[model samples]
Target: MAGRLLLIWRLLVRDLRRHRTETLLLLLAITAATATLTLGLTLHELVARPYEQTRAATAGPDLVVQAGQPGPHSLDALAPLTTLPGVTNHSGPYPLAFLALTAGDTTARVVVEGRDGTPAAVDRPAVTDGTWIRPGGVVVERTFADALGVHVGDTVSVAGHPLGVTGFAVTAARPAYPRAGWHLPGSILTEGGGLVWVERGDIATLAGEQPLSYTVNLRLADPQAGAAVIDPSGGDARFRGWRFSTGQEIADTNGRLNAPAQQALMIGSWLLTALAVVGVAGIVAGRAIGQRRRVGLLKAVGAGPAMIAAVHLAEYLVIALAAAGTGLAVGWLAAPPLFRPTAGLLGSVGMHPPPLRMVAAATALALTIAVAATLAPVLRAAATDTTHALADAAVPPRRRRWVISLSRRLPIALLIGVRINARRPRRAWLVTVNTLITTTALAAALMALAQERSPVDLGYSKLPDARDERTTQAMILVVCVVCFLALLNTVVSTWTAVLSTRHPLAVTRVLGATPAQAGVGLAVAQLLPAIPGVAAGLLLGILTFFAGDDNQHAPASWMLTAGLGVPLAVVALTAIPAVAAARRPVADTLQAGVR
Candidate 1:
């Protein structure tokens, strides 16, 4: 057992050093998968951690009740809330008013909160830079201030009042600038806007007859009980058009600020993983085919099937281990930016590594893909016959009666192309399946972007913000990454096919076939399977991502174009490398086996 292990180890090490490019390809494929998985798994925590930190730093409220109409009467409406059964403590009747702030060339819609210099028990915003609300100074939310490039001592005109930006602060009571509040309950009442903290006496200057909402922050014994604790029927002096939100709901809403975008990214990661599987499998098969002579020689030397298989499998195992570590590091670093869109609400998005469970799962998943991809090819190599391995002759092309009879009437290039595909039907099918998976992901991403772009009549006015744009960007990023890897896979597969058929192609050139025909033949082999693959991908994409969203409409024309275009595009991409390989001197190619 020790002797056999030593043999396998030596063989694996020698082959890895010799086939450096192939080894690197294997490493990159798995690394991409693991990195994507790590990012997807840690996305929630990426947002959750910052939220918790900010919530802890500032005594964020459990519930917020806002009266739509402003005045002393509005304050009176919320005074009865302290007597509620579950209410423990409360803050406000703070004055909330929406007004525009202008600084130089920039004009920002901002929600100004009137606060006293005294600190409160609930929703106490922690000062990040400079001091809290002072007599003649205004404090800006950290993210909002960062966006406008406003610093301490900078003056900004708020409702035509030039207030000094005395400080920067962060709070858990409200979302950062541009996502003032949630969309469902009181979206209009609190339209997306930046937040500002000002002295209570400054409220009149900013208000200037502009509408105001009197907001009260409530701390309940049971934060989860929420609006249910409030008896609407009972004459508790409830204000007309009052909106109430629970602490738990606020936390969840804050946590999921970028939920749609994160979900899209996670879905994209899984798609990339699928592509990695197909790509790795194709690469392994190519490697096995290329090393057929080596496999036969091993068998002739009296190596057992199990021993030979281990040598081949061990190469990927070593690479997989290295790739898992690289991928984990890359993903850990890449995840912080993904949560930046919600950084305003969360305060400081920390670079916390993905949980250990997630890392383990990602590593396991990558290793599984590596093993699965190589299994079939390794088995084929192990099962090679000693006599055939020593001889190293190419497989005889199967005679096709229909093809031969019909080819006389067709162009030489097209006929040759058709013949090449017929010779290796299985390989052609595998390439086709890969194309299908790639195009399906592309189609789904496009569909998602289309949905995000199209206007949805949700029976209310929607706030203009970065949330939708961020989601679209996430989908686009995924599409780009997937397409790039798929492109690389296509090139590699084409090059491998060219290498395998070099002898046969050289013989054909000697029999009056031109370089162009050989190249076309090579491209044709990949394109034939692509037709059905593209069609299947389109259908699958529509069924998978387009079915659930009622607000989205399908772009039948675009899907059709994509299905047709992708196969032709593959042919174009494959042609250059195919032609280059075909143009190699026939003598040198024929003598390659002898060397």
Candidate 2:
């Protein structure tokens, strides 16, 4: 058994070294799929890490209670909760003043909270730059400050009063910037804005006649008991006009913001995996045709079918494993940036080893794509009779009276292209599927772009909703990758067709067909199947992504462009390889075919 294993290993190494380009193509196909799969599976965890760090560093409260309506007595209404059951520690019924803030040329609605000069026991904002809030100075939430381009020493007008920026800080008491506005009393539907802090003494003066809301941060004996602690059903009148949020709830909210990006990635990963299957299947099929003689030689030397199959599969299995590892590393390193922490959170998320489950899933996908694509072709090659394989005779092309009659009146290029496609119908279909996947992905990206109405209003300037921006980005990435893989598949299929038909094409050349005709025939073969593919792809893209959302349909002009453009691109991609193969010296090709 050990000797047999060694023999098989040697055979695999020699084969891989001999066919370096094919091996590299297989690796590229599987690695692309696995990397995208890894990103889809692990992005949520990656995005959550920074928020967790922020929560821990700030000693974030288990529950935050906010008054529903701003009034002088809001603090009194919230005071009773400080000593409530299960409360271990508490931070003030801090005064919250909703006001417009203007810094530089930007103006935004902000929730200005009044904080003591000293840090509280719970929900303390960690100063990242400069000092904490002082008597006439204000501190801006780190993300908010970054958005406003305000640093320490800059003055921001709050409700028409100018106060010098004292510091920039982050806190877990509120969801990150743009989301913090959700906590405002009586403003649950308000668009996300920013948060800032001022000395407690400055609140009354800055607010003037504006009613003030209050919030209390509580540390519960059981952090998870927050929901239970807050009376629901309005059974207690004291709980009326108030809202309660648990730390877990806050974390979930922040995490939910990444759902769009995650959805795009997950969907794109599957699309890419499908393309990998199609691309690898074509490569394997072509390689099988080229390897018949080798299979015959092994059989003549007494190699059994199982040994033959194992030798073939081992090469791909090794490549697949290597691809999986490469993909996992790339996915891990790439994820943090795609689902990066919003500026609102403290600490940065860096690349870390993916979880075991994610690694397993990615590896499984790569191996599955390899096995599924290669198995049938390899098995067929293994089962061929030794004499037939050794002879390496090409199968005779099937003739039909209707096909001959139809081609008689057609142009030389179209006639040859039709016959060529008829000879290798399976490769033609793979090319079709390749075009379909690319078109579908491109259409989906266009739909995503068309659906955006406007950026979220962030006071001073509009910013794209993080979710929309990330989703669009993910879609664009998927489209680009799918297009790249499709282009590769086109080139491979066209070249393989060119090689398979060289003898017949050379005969046609001798019969007065020009090299350009032969080349255009090859391109035409790919384009014939692509017409239906592009149409199906447009329909699929619409059904999959725009079915329920009437507003998400891409403009008719864009759809028309994609429909016409893809086949043209297919023609362009196939032309290079087709022309190169067609222009090969006919005399040489014919002699090789005869030998």
Candidate 3:
């Protein structure tokens, strides 16, 4: 048994080394799918990580309460909540001044909050750059600072009062920039802008007449009891006219911000995997044709069907494992940049190894695709009779009377193209499926671009939505990858067709067909399948992405472009290999076929 296993390993290694190009192609197909899958599966956890880190580092609050009305005495109403049961520690009803801020030529509405020189027991913002707030100096929230392109030494004006930028900080106490808190002197329905921190005295000095609201951050002994602490059913007057939020609610909101990106990646990964399956099946079919004689040779040496199957399976199993590892590493490294952490969170988005479950899931997917593709071809080859396998004769193409009758009336190139497709209907379908996936991805990308053109209303002003921006980016990325794999698949399928039909095409060339006619015939086979694929893909893409969204519509121009462009692209890709095969010396091809 040990000796047989050793022999199988040697055979697998030698076979892979001999077909290095095919081996690499298999690896590329599987790795592309697996890497995308890894990114999709792990992105949500990665996006939520910074918030958790910030919460732990800053001793973030369990509950935050904001006064509904702004006045100098608002703190008097909020002060007693710090003494409520389950409130272990608290940061007071700090004064909040709603004002417009200007830095350089850019201006935006901001919430300027007053803080002490020393850190508060709860909800202390962690300074990421420079120092904490000081006299005549103001700290900017990290995300807001990024938007303004300001740093520690720069100065920004608050309600027209210029203050030197003291430092940059991140906090779990509020949602990231562009949503720091609500704008004041209006209904809280208005969109909030950014956040800046200054000393208590500066707040009174800078806002002589601006309305002031108060907010208190509370750290509960039991974080989950936040709802009970602020229960309105108690009829406590202090709870009235105050907005309260729990830590869990805030974390959930932060996580929701990444929902668009996560959905795009998850959907894209499945599309890519489908394309990979079609491509791998073609590669396996082509390799099986070339390996028939090898199967016969193994059988002659007294190898059983099980051993022969094992030998073929081992080669792909090794490649699958390698591809899975490479994919996991690529996905893990690529995710942080693609996610592009918003200035809202505390920690820099850094590379962390994916968790063990993600690694396992990606590996399992790769192995499954490899095994599924290779099994049918391996089993068929093993079952071939020894005599027929040793002869290595081409399987005669089954002639259909209707196909023959129809082909006889067509032009020579069209006749040849139609017959080639009829001979291998399965290959034609694979080409169709490949084109379908590519066109669907292209159409989805166009739809996303169309939606981006519409303005997003934020109640206060129109601004680009961060979620929409990320979703658009993710779609673009997925389209690029799917197109590349589709391109590779096109080339591979065309070349495989050329090899399989070499004998018949050579005979036709010898019988008076021009080389150009033969090449065009080969390209026509691919083009025919692509037409239906393109049409179906466009319909599917529109239904999948554009349905139920009143703001989004399928642009006719975009649909027409994809419907016409994909088939042309397919013809162009197929022509390279087709022309090369047609130019091969007819005599040599005929001689090889006879052997």
Worst 10 residues of 2 by lDDT: 181-190
Model 3 TM-score (2 dp): 0.92
Q: Please list all clashing residue pairs in model 1, or write none if there are none.
A: 62-247
Model 2, residue pairs in steric clash:
107-459, 107-460, 108-459
Candidates' RMSD to native: 4.7, 2.6, 2.6
Q: In model 1, where do residues sit more than 4 Å from their true spots? A: 62-110, 118-122, 128-131, 142-162, 177-179, 182-193, 208-247, 297-304, 346-350, 397-400, 407-409, 441-463, 534-569, 591-595
Q: Kindly indicate the candidate among 1 and 2 with the higher TM-score.
A: 2
**Which TM-score value belongs to model 1?**
0.81
lDDT of 2 at 74: 80
Q: Write the per-residue lDDT of candidate 2 for residues 1-595, one digit (tens) a residue.
A: 8988999999888989899988888888888899888777666775477777888899899999887788977877788888888899999999998788899878887888999988799998889999999998999998778667888999989989999998999888887667776334566565678889999999989888877888899999988787577674547876665678888878887777778788888888999999999988888887887888989998999999998899889988999999999888887777767666456776554434567888889899999999998999889988899999999888788888888899889999999888987878888899888888888888878877888557668655676676776677778877887888787777777757776788888998999999999989888988999988899999888777755645667899999999999998988888888888889888998889731
| lDDT score at residue 590, model 1, on the 0-100 scale | 85
- lDDT tens digits, residue span 1-595, model 1: 9988898888888889898988887788888878777766656666667777777777777788887566677778778886788889888879877777776667767778899899988889888789998877899988777667788999998878889988998888876665555232234444555788899999877788765667888888987777766754634464446677765665676556567777877888787787777778778867876687888888878898998888888888889888888888877777677546544554432355567787787789788888888888888778888888777778788988998888767787777777777777767776777788788887887677577553212122233345576677777777777777777678767866887788888988989998988888888777877888888898788778855647474577877777877887798888988989889888999888621
> Measured by C-alpha RMSD in angstroms, how accurate is candidate 1?
4.7
lDDT of 3 at 287: 82
